[model samples]
Target: MPLSRTVRCICIEISKKRFNPKSLEKLEIIPASQSCQHIEIIATMKKTGEKRCLNPESKAVENLLKAVSKERSKRSP
Candidate 1:
């Protein structure tokens, strides 16, 4: 499905930051248009399992979250 305009805007904001694969828990690309794509990242809390969409505008926070996610993966089997 095509991403909403708000999501598209958020994705645009995200693309401007430094790319760090380690910071992202899960990243998926959803087709937005014939010439563009939308990105979705999983933003969740480790202790509570609460989930939310990544905020594209917050580079520092996103990077930190992604790092945490990476650490969790390493701790798992």
Candidate 2:
């Protein structure tokens, strides 16, 4: 299934980060609440202890920042 506009936007924002752009393809946006519009964006690094939680709002940007920081840490030996 094709991704929603909101998901696409979030993916685009995530792709802008320094981490592997292909990782965005693995991103999953799941609805957190059936009643409300709250959603969760999840991204997991392969074989690495990296996971991120983000909302579609401003928190998404913050989460992406954290993801980048984590990516940097993983890259650093």
Candidate 1 lDDT tens digits, 23-51 = 44444334456444554554444445544
In candidate 1 the C-alpha lDDT for residue 28 amounts to 37
Show where candidate 2 strays beyond 4 Å: 1-18, 35-37, 55-77
Task: Estimate TM-scores for all models.
Answer: 0.32, 0.34
Worst window of 10 by summed lDDT in candidate 2: 8-17
For model 2, residues 1-77, the per-residue Cα lDDT tens digits are: 88564553323333323455345434566654543345556666565646655344434445666787999999999
- lDDT score at residue 59, model 2, on the 0-100 scale: 43
> Going through the candidates in order, what is the number of backbone clashes in each?
1, 0
In model 1, where is the ten-residue run with the lowest total lDDT? 8-17
lDDT of each: 0.51, 0.54
Task: State in Å the error of residue 11, model 1.
Answer: 12
